[model samples]
Target: MGLKKYTNINNIQGKKGSQFSSQLRGINLERVLIVAIDAAKFYQKALLCNYYGDVLERPFFFGVNQDGLNLLCSKIEEARMEIQAERIFIGVESTAHYYEDIVYELGKRGYGVTIINPATTYEERASALNWSKTDDLDLYAIAHALIQNKGMENKLPEGAYRKLMKLTRARRSEVQKRALVRIQIRTLMDHIWRDYQGFVEIENNKPKKKLIFSDFWGKSSLFFMEHFPHPSSLIDLGEERVWEISKENKLRIKETHIQTLLYVARKSIIKSTEVVSAELLLLRLAIKDLKRLDENVGLLEKEIEKELLQTDGRLLLTVPGIGVVTAAEFYSELGDISHFDNAGQLIKKAGTNPIIIQSGGTQGFYGRISKQGNKHLRFMVYTVGKSLAQHNKDLRPYYERLKERGKHARKAFIALGNKFIKIAFSMLKNRKPYESKQPDYRIFTEVKKKLLYTKMNTYLNIALAA
Candidate 1:
């Protein structure tokens, strides 16, 4: 069999009536006014042009504050009166957060605003054979994009969705900060107790790898780190004193682990006692910061849970592996589910959909994902995939099948992620919870309990104390 060749691929087009096309269909081009804006930190550049690419007004700068906004409104009204324009279309480049204020303000005034992607404007400029860039050039690019009906209606979400977006993004930042603190703590431990995290031990005249404690942040490990970072201190305290302190703090410490800590302390390398003492202070401070950050994260999680429950996102909890955090993050990134027509659109928005590449008389082939959509959404979907593969019995089999077919673990997870998107999309759109094909009593009972009695506050309280 011969390979299939990709031909006649140049005619790919976007769906009709998805942008401003429907409104412009029967309208006269001459009377339509196109207002293009290039936003900046403190000021913005704008120009007025008619629908037929004729500049009606030269590019002008306006401040981005209240007085400036009034000037902008007056300018648009003046231009409308001069041209006798019946329809007006305003386009602004989505430059960081600079365009947000204008979009919101204009939207509130009942002016139709189209948020243009910076990439679209750049391409428009390049097409005109003008490589040099400036605020003036950007205005022309934005105008051209709007004339061709390119841009999006970026209606900022309100109420609970807005709150979810903020909280979820904040939670991600806190998580990253916590991870950095963990790294700093490990670095300090390396200098103080060289073999604190893990070290090789000899057993039966053979090299064996051993960890003093299973988790570095476990209660007993944290107790030693807080009170006795230095080996000399651990040795000075003696096993009896260590046991007494552990009991006082209600910390469980294995006798074998304590003996191993003392052994490592005796033989471990060290610097001057003064140097150790200074590092200890920094280490304790870092630990304190870590604890505070953890509490903040727990509090944020509680808020996210409360917000998620208010929206349909809580239905995601019906899936065995999906949790409140993952659901909230996904929903926040996704915004309103009503905007998506299907699961495929959601996947495309996440940039997880595979790319199609075909050119030069070669057969069409699937390439890597575009990775051009919301990166946080992509991350959350992958997280859901990981959770489902580990805990969701129904989805685990599919994940295993992918691996059996020689897919890498990461690739398998992404495949599962796409499938999960379909599941989630259907669940959200239909306002239904997840249901397994085959009846399983245990999963049913667990899911029912989760849906009916989600005691999120209990976990938050424990986390706050920790």
Candidate 2:
């Protein structure tokens, strides 16, 4: 069948045209063909359009495999030839991992690609046309958004940064799995030994005593659970046997722990029996899984550390309290800080920037953060910010001042997060290690004045050179 044509560019030239014109200044629209694909798991729905949001062809469907990618590329070539376009710009919605293969394929075929956030396409649909949803409609929205330049340039990580991301993400997944197993173990313990937590308590000078097994996932606790699944089993083994088991497992605990366990076992309301054998089995399985996950996490961390050392990530370690893990996370997420124009952009990308709410002539008040960017990066920034607020010399005073001014704990943390972004950005951009001492006010003033006079590109070049 012949390709369908849409020549009424003026109809879409009102708001979308102006937005595109402002954001996309240099690109000549007349010679460029825009291809937007609504990516899915099994298939992709695509629309080919011209520079001014004119559809040059009807929506096309293609598979996601090798044959499908080739068909899609051939269709794109056909569209380019029909439109007599000099360049092709392919736009695809970033729908999880569904778009990765297509994007990589398009890149390998030498097409300029933009990865549009699904949120952007949704907003575009809502604003441009109040229509029902379909694959074709979604494809239209993606194409429309691309013509308006409402997407990010698709640039995948490479080298050490790529490996770091893979390792860190795997580690995070394993940690989450481990946490789930711990919860399951705790739930099983509640049924089999409800007051097991009270067995060993250390008397501190503080009012609240500390339980040794409060960390339910500790090595000793897991060993105890695996060997003696219930209180009756523990009592049957006797205190000396328990101590012997602890010694065999190389657990550094006092003999008093055994006495505590025996006492709690005698007073325990729950008793072990053949009926509870199922619970014991579950407990043993959970412990085994937890141990495997722990080993996996440790191995992934070691690999992450090794990969991080190969990059300039070690420079981040110069900042007090920013250890290898936090630094590696930042490196993996940011993927070369030189790409960012300024620290504010980095902060916004991390989603720590405060959201301002206002309407009409009303004054705007700062609400919570947008939380619209990389949540993992935001979490890492928050944790690093908390550490800095407590320990970093310059940041601690700032944190205390905010607290003294009655700022909420979370708000203070957000503020510290913002500060951390700025400091880290400057340090990384300038290739300078962090200094604990605060700079002189005079030097700060001079630096601010110099920044004002310096062109942005020139400043970036200088920073990159450093």
Candidate 3:
């Protein structure tokens, strides 16, 4: 095995191990106290010990409240007085989100608290006590992990960073919910009109599948479905009436598309004609749910934009492929870029850095990514990578080169994600906007989207009357 180096705080195996070691450098072993806590939702168990594994206080339980916090503090003070400890190091297992309160409270009172990974504690226990387990044993494992510096100091986000984190996560949840609603609506559409979305048309003894609207959720298509869900209803309304409705709503639908839709309606089949009324009611309800989710998502994005603009993360928008939502989500996960010493640190944090393997007398080669850090952050980086690969003129060449070198598409995207981290790190650290060698057309695209959105809302209001 190679000799171990106790520097680089970015090491995935033991984050901030060096910092913890530096704090213990010339101190008397017995005088240094380590407090290990196993946190739960309602109560927590804490134990105090000296550097040499001498127990200073027996394990005790306290509720997760102000009174419980005071009791824990009193116990720590008593142990410190009895042991005459000059330095105190506290560690707590990251048990769900229950540990947040204790960590935040202890930090406020000026205690140096390290957030221990549960995996480290589990390994420490397995190595020491085999399969046996208990709260007391877990506490011992926590202390051992602390002694080895197997955790990182808690750095809680504040102000805009905190808001962005919460808002971005909320937005992600809402988006996922909206997607489920879309699926439900599609299921209902299939029941109501089996061939409304597309149908076979015969001409000169050749059959061709014709799509009335490329997007089933488009304004014109949705309006047609909402007002005239049944094929018979469309046939009765006739071509002239449909054209008048489109003109009145300013839908600007193509005449050919309208004719094709009517033809499909004449030939489309309904799964059950008797239950058509029931299906229509359910479809209207589903559409209402979709509209509500759409409004919620819109409101969330606006809030996210407000929070993002208040931080240095706003500079991320200068990149061609990045938008307000992507920039905000990426920045929310990466709080305070100064915490990272280099772009490599950011890559490691996202767990996008490749793993390496080497044997004796052989050159080391990279394997897959570690996949050990913030998974959400990793996903955001990967998304940004896909965007960059497809739309970024400056970065697309590098992505193509990776693919040409026999890298898989996903691997190429991951490599681009690491590059995005480097670019983002430098941009945030130096407070510079991205400067592309080629002209950035994304700005014009964004302006066009805004104009179209305004026009869409006006047409939607007119179509709602139909």
Kindly give the stretch of ten consecutive residues in candidate 1 with the minimal lDDT sum: 7-16
| lDDT tens per residue, model 2, 1-466 | 9965433244354333444554445656766788989898976788888888777878878998788888888888888788778667689887877888888877887876788767678777776666544546787788887776666546666778778887888888899998899889888888888777654344574455435465666777777778776888878888888888889989877787777767878877875467677887888888889889989987887777666655667567667666667778877887777766678767766778788999999999988887645566788778887888876677888888989999897778778978988888887787676676755423223223323223445433543554
* Per-model tally of clashing residue pairs: 0, 0, 0
Residue 88 displacement (Å), model 2: 2.8
The residue-level lDDT of candidate 1 at 400 comes to 98
For each candidate, the alpha-carbon lDDT, in order, equals 0.79, 0.74, 0.80
Query: Over all chains combined, what TM-score does candidate 1 have?
Result: 0.84
Query: TM-score per candidate, in order?
Result: 0.84, 0.81, 0.82
lDDT of 2 at 384: 80
The sequence of per-residue lDDT tens digits that candidate 3 reaches over residues 1-466 is 9977566544444445556666777888899999999999776899999998888888999988889999999999998998888889899987877988888898888896887766568778887686435648989998988888766436666778778888888889888998998887778778888788687878999999878899888889878777777788888889999899899998889988889888888777645457777888888887888888888988888787666655677678678888778888898877788777788867876778898988998999999987645667889888999999998899999999999999998999999988989999998998877778885455334323433123434433432443
Off by over 4 Å in 2: 1-30, 128-135, 199-215, 355-372, 390-393, 400-408, 438-466
lDDT of 1 by residue, 1-466 (tens): 9966432332232332333555666677888999999999977989998998788888888987788888888889998998888889899987877888898898888887887766677778887565534547778888988888766445766778779988988998999999999999999999888888988878899988788889898888887888788888878898888778888998878778888888887777866669777778889999999989998998898788777777788777778887777888888877787876678777866778888999999998877776645667788878888989998888999999999999888878888999999988888888777887656634335534653235655433433443
Higher-lDDT candidate among 1 and 2?
A: 1
Which residue pairs in model 2 clash with each other?
A: none
Clashes of 2: 0
* Best-performing candidate as measured by TM-score: 1
